[model samples]
Target: MVSFKKLTIRDILFRSRMAYYNRPSLAFVGQEPVTYADMAVIVRNVSGMLNTLGIGKGDKVALIGENSPNWGMAYLAITSMGAVVVPILPDFSGHEMESIINHSEAKVVFVSAKLYGQLDRKNIPGVIAYILINNLQPFDESVTTPTAGMPYETPKAIVNVDYCDCELPRPDEDDLAAIIYTSGTTGRPKGVMLTHKNLVSNVLSTLMIQEVNENDRLLSILPLSHTYECTIGFLIPMATGASVYYLDKPPTPAVLIPAMQAVKPTMLLSVPLVIEKIYKNKIKPELTSSSLKRKLYSFTPTRKLLHRIAAKKLHKTFGGELHFFGIGGAKLSFEAERFLNEGRFPYSIGYGMTETSPLLTGSSPKLVRFRTAGFSIPGQELKLLNPNPHTGEGEIIVRGANVMVGYYKDPELTQTMFIDGWLRTGDLGYIDSDGYVEIRGRSKNMILTASGENIYPEEIEDVINKHEFVLESLVYELRGKLVARVHLNKEALEKYYENLKHSAKDWQHNAEEHTRKVLDEIMNYVNAKVSKFSRLNHIVEQQEPFVKTPTQKIKRFLYKE
Candidate 1:
């Protein structure tokens, strides 16, 4: 890891220019690259704009938008000028968005025009202004023009409103950097207050774990509003003088592939679902066209060749030097991880909840470990509380600088989260002798059988995830019987059945046969690998896919009876 013994966020940004001197720091779709020189100017412009608006030290501002260069600019502008930034997820529903705005008490809101309508001003307090990003609609006197430059001028009536050059306050490291709302799996969202020290320290610690340099170019697709991207993608890259690119539109294969190949990014931070979908839907069918290709893929010798081809193909997609491909936000299937590993692809598995500034553990290229999530990140503390001796598993507890200050303004709920100052991470997992952390499902998500056996649905789902035709699986007990609700891969199924000698009566018959075969294979494999208590009894197939979060994690509670 790079040493930042005396570095601050300001120092990190400025020092990188000295190191990488002439590199681009940011590139937006269809826009000119913002060089290190331009970065300084933009930051100052942001400071000037805030000063003009009477926003200063200790003020709270909310930035709500899709992942874009402007999003990063707004965040840095606010935090650098001694104000707290509240990053609202762009996909948040109208009610959730309103609740966060009211709770954060932000005096200014920077929102995308598409989502601006979702915010109701009734609950927001003293919001001096609303700045539209890329929208040209007329607003109140407080609506300001974008600092980078706007073709349209401020109306004469609002022209004299103050946009000043007041000095930016120099806040202490302990000052709040952001208040991020975590997508609660079982309850309403909580605003996790992360201080400047919390975010900067986490970025430094991550740099220590993974050695990224000034030349490293990163493709930023994860929501900047999320801690995962803010910490790893934005802050870390800026700290090291790496240029970050934001897509013009949503991240589909068509949009991402061109951006990736053009940028030839050195790094990519993403969820497992992205790669898993590509593998199951695109890669699997190509490899199983004939019995020989299928047999060859199953064999280690031939699998190595397949892996090389896959790595090369992926390399082409990412523009090479694709040294670090990180997967997080949810558990990945064994098959997907194995393919990447066997193909000699470099990737990392990270594990953390939003509360820890999200970097509790991760694996690097040199220290790759597939099954386990990896050792704790530098500087954080971890422990398991109330372990089950036999299984060596229990609730995961963490305490460190990276942990959020507290849930925003909800002292009662916040008090319950910290048991003797250690954050009660709802996850259940254990550490290995080598210090690696392997996470099981959530402690609250565990289902106990009538026979006095405790079973984890996520563990069974992980096993089922390995099947070729399965996209996602959710396991839960219904009427004393363990059942699995699964989503089949329609495209993969159609291709597989098309190759069959006998024509099926209908698509339903073909799907039933495929489902039965998959269930029998997965059941036999899991039953052999797991204890009888953990084995699933029956499987249910759905033509429709389960609704998922941005990270592709199935909202289990949404499908519950």
Candidate 2:
């Protein structure tokens, strides 16, 4: 258990010191497992370096990278020193990254080697340096003559610095911690300003629910720029003295599974898409085999026994300490919930936005429910605003210490996002008698049926995702009819027979045939379960995955009905 410390600079420094003193043996897995004491030393050094560079209280410092121990260390060093940290998303383009750096008024940027060239020095104003994270190939010298000392050529462009070892600085808890930019359903990305108190409060509150410990190991693969990853991945682990691991490459199953096996993480945190894909591609097909096999597996006695065996095998694959599997970022499918429930898996679901330090509500170990995003978290006050008379559902409004100060330099947008004192979540949901919040869908994503009935695209997409051959699917309306564009699994199709040539051209032909077979079975299966209004009108094949967020949630705004 973490020793409760006063929420101050001294307290965080105390925590960092405790990590060095007590949990020095703990390992953070990246290219290798690094000790807590070593990490603290690095943080201290980096802080000193920042202080030497004249970066102190309230100054914005930018970092762009995928998830890694270095990213977390950099953020901690910056925030601990009272400087505002601006984490640029790995997916951001050169223009987008530049805009954020300029808008946030970041004096210096620590960027990954892969993205160093994305910086068009001309666009970034008032920036003193662009520090290469790993090692950028020393800029091309052929374009212009090289600088006097630096490897890069000196033009009118901005100066680039090479990041090296540094000492750490300490910041007070009242300081502005970070400015996280979130691209909403519409309009430009808005930077949500969060203070150290706002972040540390949410981290502690989340830890109260997640119940992590020094013995626990967290595997972090989500974009560090996102608030969800920032709070849960970095802060939660640091406070609990738990070690963190991150994938070196993108989190595709090829890279992720190997990393998971190597790390054997005690907790796996992810959005719904990751597990949804596993269930759709891996589990659902086994359920749809032969009628006899399906019936045998569905029997209560047999199914429960099978789940027990599967869970045991899964635990072994996860290094025998896998206690918690957290799914958030989007609503989970009911079918997937049923499978996990039957397996008695130790899984939890949560719901939040970047504005609330991203943890408004979460499930407890003893009180987890599959359908709801769980009860309101500690320190958070939740209320419904303007319920629909017919539906009894309304927007989820939140007020808490974890809530952000406001959108950076965008008071108009910030004002619109909040109502009175509560942060308007824009999610349509209702709190049940049990105090659990059940979400229906985003208010902006709701579609109207021809009969004026409201339909949630997520609802239909959930059903379509249960298909065996489908990797992903997006539900939308086209020409006044509900349509689903399904992305078929190319590898799975070819592997279906072990020697089949299920090429792209064959996808259109095979997709129709496969879709017909799968859809017929699914339609017949789900017909009795859903209302007449919830049925899909058509299903189309999509060649590519839908554009999604870092969490793998489909960008609804990019797709039209």
Candidate 3:
């Protein structure tokens, strides 16, 4: 076994092959699994192909695709050979994708078939070649043979090391490994420059807290372009020789339930939205249907017993072998968190951003505290800066090996984000005496009251979201007054109306009045619980669900006044 202390990703790949050569490594659920030996061959051939195309150390290669075995292979091949891998989120629009490709100055691009149409060749004229991720076929003027119009010859796989003639340059610990562009909720996207050391160090540090082994199986659902998934979901599992399964389609309940049963995954990586929806739509209805059931759920002892029963069913639905159900990307809803705690689910919360190689703090399932995102990972120091006197909340700053080198090509912007070598996270949080980190909200999103009080909208929104008729809520300050934009649960509201026969007469008018009344009721309910400054002055009905990032975080800037 090789020591992770000094090994880069390339070294780890070789070690994995030497030890678990024939073990199942990566696969799409229901698809044939790729062994470590085969994966090595693919990576080697891809590297050889890139070499033949005149790409080498420090060259940028953009990989845009949904999660697949090939996507993972392409990432390993690009980074292992001292080149930078630029992963574009597949959800990005055509213009956004082109902007990233041009901005990153990627010499070569590997795109999936589904996203191939998004690339405007004229926009990204700098790219020398474009290869389809589904199959390593190149499309470029340079790819044609000297005979003028003949397709480029695809590189053949070389199995025997003695017969191969490809030079693989070793990446230094500080070498730029990836340039991940932030899908910023506001402003233009900036590429986050992360080194090989940043990623490898974070991987090891995460494994120290959350133990994973060769026998562990991971079912990945989050976008691989997101650092949270790229690091822990893909890299950690690869480092530990764990088998990772990707969904063949979107991870909706219809597809996910069957796949879960098949994979029986030991570890599952997800954002809070997925589980929260399940709790709201599936579990909540069942719990609140009858007076007796509602009463049973209100009392502590009986509620916990009900939650335990529900949790067992949920566990069985998630393949029954789940040891770690890790959640991150956004704050988990209060109602869902309570159920998870009472039910004794193995789920835990993590907090980090793309700039930190995404794992700053995480809790183990056994040691998890409700609502907190666990302690800082080993080798990282998380501290609150400029704490408020009344409330200890302050901007979270972190310093560690896991931190990125800087934002790519934006030294001025990068300089502003750091103070004395510690990266300012911009997220407001507090660390308890026991070392758990509880995030309040983004510092930028905090509302400053007229009386000089700082109000976190997330806290208010959490309360509003707990209402039966509300699906999601956003709190923003409008002209120094707190206001809420809420997207109501249409299904729940319709069900309510259907139960009243008189409501069917002039339903449209009646529903409008009913909605207004409910919104007013919700506002009063929230205002009564919160402090005077934190109370919402108005609640505006949002006709549509707020647009969200890939992780399902509402794009706050999009809805900003």
Candidate 4:
């Protein structure tokens, strides 16, 4: 019921900060949290400091960091003061970071201490200064900054602007708030331009599906740079007076389990891979550890019971208070979805991209279907273009208030993104009679078979990933034959060898033979589940896991044969 169409990012900040003035806003685990009152003053100080550095409205300010309270504060400070923020993912390689910096022509960079070394501003011009985010100190005195010393500590020229100050070219609902360069599967990093309204629209529409309030505690595991996290995980929490906790390190099990207990997060937003890994690597193995249990797990009624038992333990392991477990960025594996549905875990799958303000079609935990991405959000239109007659699948085109304005400065690329009036998602899906959206796969990832069958490799990959020994798998075409490169779990492979009697000369030979047999079994198992055209001809073992984008999506461009 909260209307935010006319509100800018700055307006949202002032409203929420004043309303929840003394409430905790952001914190690191086991550390003193920053209250809304504290964040307001900090954001104000940081904005005043940026202004002192000659940074003004429409100036590009870049931010790169691991997920932390400072990162969240910096984002607010940059956008609230009318400067466009360019958020670079922490996982971006040195070359990738340099490319983004050079392309964006950022006047100022606010980088965290951990990822500071990646910024090579050797010959890049127009860069005014690099400010360290943690302490807000001058990162580089060599740059042509307005002042040499700390402006955050003591600014030479400070313009104290009130929330209702009248000024020309000030932060507006239509003004460009952030330009996020997407590290997509296409290998082209294009800047996605989102306005204050674009982001706030998503935050408000998301609230329609789920409620976040002052009493809510959120454990943020995804990168703050990602729109999925930036809008839903960060902005949504800020708007509704919820508290968010971030981890200084990566979200490994050892680090997360303890943090979950400490924070007792009421809601968590994640990509499918994170929860899928938890289900695959931990819960499933523990439940079917014995032969008798495996037999019981094969039956539908008994499998549901086993999944329910494991899901209860899993819920407690995540601090026992998680209500809305929102998964997005990629499709949830059907096997994993069945587990969550049967186990009665409060999980919801969201489907969208950075260009759509990261949420176009999604459901709340209670409204979710087993494998559907639910209906379009409020104020959005979703329709299929050129849908197949039989399957009813086509490119999922959308037009919505939450959609990005366009790709930054690249008019050609921006023009190409939209067709007629709707933005071309390039995702293949269909709307069911009941209005549930089922995404088949990306249109680019679909393989056109010699027999003229449209095969989605992702669907096959999902089946392949369900195998116990298979950690992950990538399905691709090789010389007109479907082949999969599988990354096996070393421990699971070894366990297979331990449980079986193999005719091999030595331990090494036995392990190798057992691995080959296991991969073959996986291939056969996956083939049995898929249609004939989708069957994999060969299964090759990969020594290492496939390199992924920040959100754990496999960089398909890197593996193209």
RMSD in Å for all candidates: 4.1, 5.7, 3.5, 3.7
User: Which candidate wins on lDDT?
Assistant: 3
Backbone clash count, each prediction separately: 2, 14, 0, 0
2 or 3: which has the higher lDDT? 3
Candidate 1 per-residue lDDT, tens place, 457-494, comes to 99888887777777888988888888888887766666
Q: What is the full ranking by TM-score, best candidate first?
A: 3, 4, 1, 2
After TM-score superposition, what is the CA distance of residue 506 in candidate 2 from its true location, in Å? 8.7
Model 4 clash pairs are none
- Clash pairs, candidate 3, are none
Best by TM-score: 3
Error of 3 at 307 (Å): 0.7
Instruction: List, residue by residue over 1-561, the lDDT tens digit for candidate 3.
Output: 325545478877877878788888988887777888888888887887787787889999999988888889899989999999999999999999999999999999998777777667889989988877766666653553222122222233356454258777778889999999977776568899999999999998998899988899999899999899999999888887899998868888899999999999999998988888899999989987988999888899998998899999999999999999999999999999999999999999999999999899997899999889999999888899998777788899999998988888899989999999899999999888999999999989988877888898999999999988889999998887889999999888778878766465656767788889889999999999899889999999999989888778899988877
Task: Please give the TM-score that candidate 4 achieves against the real structure.
Answer: 0.94
Ranking by lDDT: 3, 4, 1, 2
